[model samples]
Target chain A: MSRALDRTGIWIGWAFFADLANALALTFGYMFSRPVTMQYPDKEKWLPYSRYRGHHFLKRDDEGEIKCVACELCARICPCYCIEVIPYEDEKGNRHPAKFEIDMARCLFCGLCEDACPADAIALGQQYEFSSFSSRDLVIGRDDLLGKPGKAATGGGVVSARLNTEQDVLVETSEPQGYNWWRNIRRT
Target chain B: MELVVALGLIVFKVALLIAILLLLPLPLTWLERKVAGHMQQRMGPMRVGWHGLLQPVADGIKLLTKEDHIPAEADRFLFKLAPILALAPPFVVFVAVPFGESVSVLGTEITLYVSNMNVALLFVFAVIGIEVYGVIFGGWAANSKYAVLGSLRTCAQMISYEIPMGFAVIGVVMLAQSMSLLEIVRAQADVWNIVYQPVGFFVFFVAGLAESQRIPFDLAEAEGDLGAGFHTEYSGIRFAFFMVSEYAIMLLTSVLAVILFFGGWNGVLVPLPPLLWFVLKVAFFVYVFIWFRFTFPRYRYDQLMAIGWKVLLPLSMANIIITGVAFL
Candidate 1:
């Protein structure tokens, strides 16, 4: 009986003080600690990674010429079938795309298009904020893909000026051929 | 003319108190979310307006606009009455709550409280006891098994906890030698009751958590098992009413705890006014409530009963005996 009473006393003491102390300690610890939220849209605006695949853009050569041989490899390899490359013979007898359209509404952003491109013409750009008002606005045509200067796409797809800022920072240095391809395209 | 003027003053005071009672929950809900968020190392709401200051406003509007859904087999009259029943008890309890010392305004001494009863403690307990009926009725009228089970749990939890809670108060009443909340505050002018009856205070605080059906004791509305418990069938503004009452009772108990233990509005060597001191004390207890909700996991139903019965009740009874002997 005495042992039971002693055990009860110990249990009660532990329950009262230990629980209160633990709660108070945790509360104060959390109060003093820095909040972990990123406060998105305003602060911490850096892109995720160098190789992070996002919106697709068509490349231009140093002389302001389209580099795509319109091999249709991207269209073939695309799991979502979002890319369409219509190859036609140009005035220089070189096969180029007459129309390059990517239904971004269907894009998986898998970076497969970038990997499959033989001429290094189509590459994924680092732009993730792409909410569109309509599905039609999501379809990127030849001029939009070519990074033309004037027309602003309604969806938060990266514009030419913004793309220029991200170009040097995001392109992987290990891929010398892709890096040189991107460098030559931006010179004009 | 004097009678008319007194009646008018009473009416005005009641209206003002009702408005405050109704509106306090809006900001409180937002505060609870923010506190819970910060405690967990995450920011709660930041989208609606400047750090989600307008979140409660948005929530109020959304609740108001939602379809008022009633289950097909529900007892419509009882279902409709339950939310109002839940809401009324807290306001009634607040009538006897003395917030601060009287101040003379325009040559008329005005008390901050709505009504000062000689048996204020009894009045608070009796009115608050009626609140469980709302839960039970809400559950029974819903005609669902989960709702019935939830209300049954609540009924048992609340009824069991009230014993320890009442005993804790009895210890304080014995110490103060008065039942009036105002008089209790006055008794603690020299020193707070918490200094004398720390055990009583601890017991009361724990019991108060169960009484308010807060987390760790919130088996009634345990989302995992009962699906929002008693208020499962309630929707839209009706659901908002139930939620508001839960917060109101929480505030009331915290305020009561302040008056009972912390010496409401009584501060030494403080330049701040008595009302501010009282409010700050109440706010501290309220923060503690939110902190506990965030930190502790919910208690299993049997463990909750065991704590209330085998732990708090016996402890409070011992505290009363100790206080009585010390007084002798």
Candidate 2:
């Protein structure tokens, strides 16, 4: 009897019992519960932190002059070699890079160029929107790199004493985390 | 008027069940990802709407907008047909499942299921057994040699594992003495099947995992060997259907496991309702399946077959014989 019962039990569970349990459970459990789904697109989300890493631009002095002194340090330290500088002599005989370019497409945003700059003129801004249809649009030039200093430009050749401070230099050109493309893609 | 009301209720219940089953797969997909992430010391999908809850929706939208691809030499008809076949069985099997007991609706005693079948157990098995056709067709229709071999391997593995799967349930039927799922659940009210047939329960669980083609036994879709396995050639909504169906089957198997051995909504007399118990049980099994999927690596194809044929089959047989002796 025990042997028969065991055989019957195994047979029943395999062939019958399992399905029976499911059938009963599902049959009785069919109360329609509302699905929990949050509709998106109509809802805008707040990001956890600021995430943009476009190109870095330096602040100029009050004399409407370029802060970069044609020192090949930024170009030399750049890992991607995306930055290009062309030095020229102005009528005043001051030697400065006539053309400075930082290719946003190739930049890794390692911040090495900023760290390498002895003059403390260049910095990575928070502006992340750097989208462009072509490569040329992403190539930031010297004029673009030389962001607006915190104060409006006064008379020429003033050599204002306020330009000596680090914070003053940053305030002059900083524009609320200027354009950065690297930070946008890397933000999880 | 009564007849019209009854027909309307049936249609409503059928639609309701299908909607629930179809939508449940989406959450299960998210849960699987999150659970896998936690196990691997990573936060899974925390960015999308609140703990990555909306990740599946984002995924759905992304796939829909992406380009659809089809192989040049593939059987377009069969390739298209495969995901449909894969997705349909689990939905069909849900028809006979009882979530709660018969309740009076509109003065008519209506069953909750889409259809009531006397041989519901065999029907579920047969339907689940036919799941192989989806994988085989997916692999074969892709027109790649890897696809063919993967499908063949899936067939063999499925067949091997199903032997033990069938054997495990035989024990339950022996105790319940009825093929009607409702009756089996009622039979287990006093004594749960798991207490009486522990060995059979283990066999069934293992077999269930293999049947669902989950991890360890997931060689059929092993990316290294088969390049996305059987559905490699499929893209766009076709791929989405394949994914949705895979998760649906997992839910089906987990639900089946709960009902078969875990008492199926009969554990405690709670004030809430019987359906709550049923849902909780199914949820536990669902999480367990996800846990197992994320914890283990895929088993080798040969080892997978050997485990099914040599290990599970023999153990299942012994379980039956031993239980038979004990009852005698």
The number of the candidate with the highest DockQ is 1
* lDDT computed for candidate 1: 0.84
After superposition, candidate 2 runs with Cα above 4 Å error: A1-68, A71-93, A104-133, A148-188, B1-8, B46-52, B61-70, B106-108
Task: Give the alpha-carbon lDDT of every model.
Answer: 0.84, 0.74
Error of 1 at B263 (Å): 0.8
Note the B-chain TM-score for every model.
0.98, 0.94
TM-score of 2: 0.73
Task: State the TM-score for model 1.
Answer: 0.88
Q: Once model 1 is optimally superposed onto the true structure by TM-score, how far is the C-alpha of residue A123 displaced, in angstroms?
A: 1.2
| DockQ (model 1, Cα) | 0.44
* Model 1, position A55: C-alpha lDDT score: 76
Q: Each predicted complex: what DockQ?
A: 0.44, 0.05
- Score every model by TM-score: 0.88, 0.73
Return the interface RMSD of the candidates, in order shown, one decimal each.
Answer: 1.6, 12.3
Cα lDDT tens digits, model 2, B25-88, are: 7798888877666554445676678888999999989888878887889888888888888888
TM-score of chain A of each: 0.68, 0.52
